[model samples]
Target: MALQIGAISQKGGVGKSSIARLIAREYAVAGWDVKIADLDIAQATSTNWKQRREQNGIQPEIAVEPFRTVTQALKHASVYDLVVFDGKPHSNRETLEIAQACNLVVLPTGLSLDDLMPSVLLAHELVEAKIDKAKIVFALCRVGDRDNEIDEAREYVRKAGYQILAGSIPEKTAYRRASDVGKAMTEISFLSLRQRAEEVAQSVIDRLSKEG
Candidate 1:
């Protein structure tokens, strides 16, 4: 069976899809069969990105497909090394089902009360539904230059009793531009930005590996 990793959040613009893409790309580059199950049928962000990636003739192709149901998506599990689910914006039956199915669930959020509060609430809901807390982790995304803000956000996560990633995705325009060309920072020409993106991707891999 393929290892399933899901990026989920109840709020929009939290960088859930971006994180999913980063992790999927990392595994793909490392020679693992990686596929992204784009569950947001309305947006289909990852599906579109995958199309763009192929059009550009990018190497190490990452397969992405849209599915109306989680069950339908799981049918391809036997063929891939990893299946990353880029979830929708709101909590629903699909969201809960993904939580139950994922080996690791990532909840991405910005460093602010508006972002943190709702995300924490959603995490709590997952636990209430009997999802393992160890498998659910919060990823700080689109962070800015304010060190204090990041520090405080980590404190909030700790106090709320949830796991958080050690690396974060900074708010960089490079990230947005890279996606335009069906590229992640790892493929970008800028060495510094590429390293930044790798930090978060590697951190996730390291953490999940230990789960074995």
Candidate 2:
């Protein structure tokens, strides 16, 4: 069975798809057969991104397929080394099932009460549903230049007794532009941005690796 990683968030626009694509690309580049299960049926963000990637002739040829159900996606898991699920933007039965299925559940959120509160609440819900707390972690995303904001966000998650990943993605126009063309963060032209993206990608991969 492949290692399943699910990017889940209760609120929208928190970079859940971006994080999933980033990690999936990292694994693909490392010579793993990586496939993404785009569970966001409404928008199919990851599915469309893969289409753009194919049109642009991107390297490593990551596969992405949309599925209406998590169980349907899991059926294809044995063929790939890693399966990254980009779930919808709501807390529902599907989200809970994805959380239960994944080896790691990543909650991406901005560094603000508005974003943090809903995400933290979702984590609590997952825990209450008997999902292993250690299998879940928060990834700070779309952050600004304010160091204090990141620090405060970290402190907030810690206080809530949730594990936050060491990797984070800053708010940058480069990410948006790159995503428009089906490019992952590690594929950007800027060396610094690519390095930051690699850091975040490797952090997640390392966390998953430790589970093995």
Candidate 3:
């Protein structure tokens, strides 16, 4: 069976789809047959991004499709080595369903309490629904360059009993520009930015390795 990874968030603009595409691209570059199951039908963010990626003739092509339901997306599990689910913007019944279905559930949030609070709450909900806490992790995104703020946010999540991914994605115009061209954060123009994004991706891979 393919290893399933879910990139979900309680609110939009938290880099959920970005993380989804990052993981898909990371695995694809590593020679794995990967596909992104874009579950956010309303926005189709990842779906549209995939079109641009193909249009630009990006390397390590990744497949992306929009699905109205989680079950519909799961149907392709056997066809690929990995399936990354780009979930809807808000948490609902389907959110828990995705958490339960995935080997790893990544909740991307900003550094502010506004973002962190809801993210931890969602994680709490997932735990309440009997999802393994170990499978659920928080990925910091759109973070500013403040060490103190970053440390505080990490402490907040840790105190809430959830693990934060090793690295955070800092807010940068370059990242947004890269996305505009159907490229992921890791595919940005600057090596520094690319390395930062790769750290998050590698942390995710390490987490999955522990699952085995």
In model 3, which runs have C-alpha deviations exceeding 4 angstroms? Answer: none
lDDT of 3 by residue, 15-108 (tens): 9999999999999999999999999999999999998998998988999999999889888778999999999976587788899899999999
**In model 2, what is the error at residue 33, expressed in angstroms?**
0.5
Which regions of candidate 1 fall more than 4 Å away from where they truly are? none
lDDT of 1 by residue, 59-151 (tens): 789999999889999997779999999999875788898999999999999999999999899999999999999998989999998889999
lDDT of 3: 0.92
lDDT of 2: 0.91
**Residue pairs in steric clash, candidate 2?**
none
Across residues 1-76, which tens digit of lDDT does each residue of candidate 2 receive?
Answer: 8999999998889998999999899999999999999999899999999999999999988999999999999999
TM-score of 3: 0.98
Report every candidate's CA lDDT.
Answer: 0.90, 0.91, 0.92
User: After best superposition, candidate 1 residue 1: deviation in angstroms?
Assistant: 0.8
Candidate 2 residue spans exceeding 4 A from truth: none
Residue pairs with clashing backbones, model 3: none
State the lDDT at 148 in candidate 1: 91
> Which candidate, 1 or 2, has the higher lDDT?
2
lDDT over C-alpha atoms for residue 158 of model 2: 95
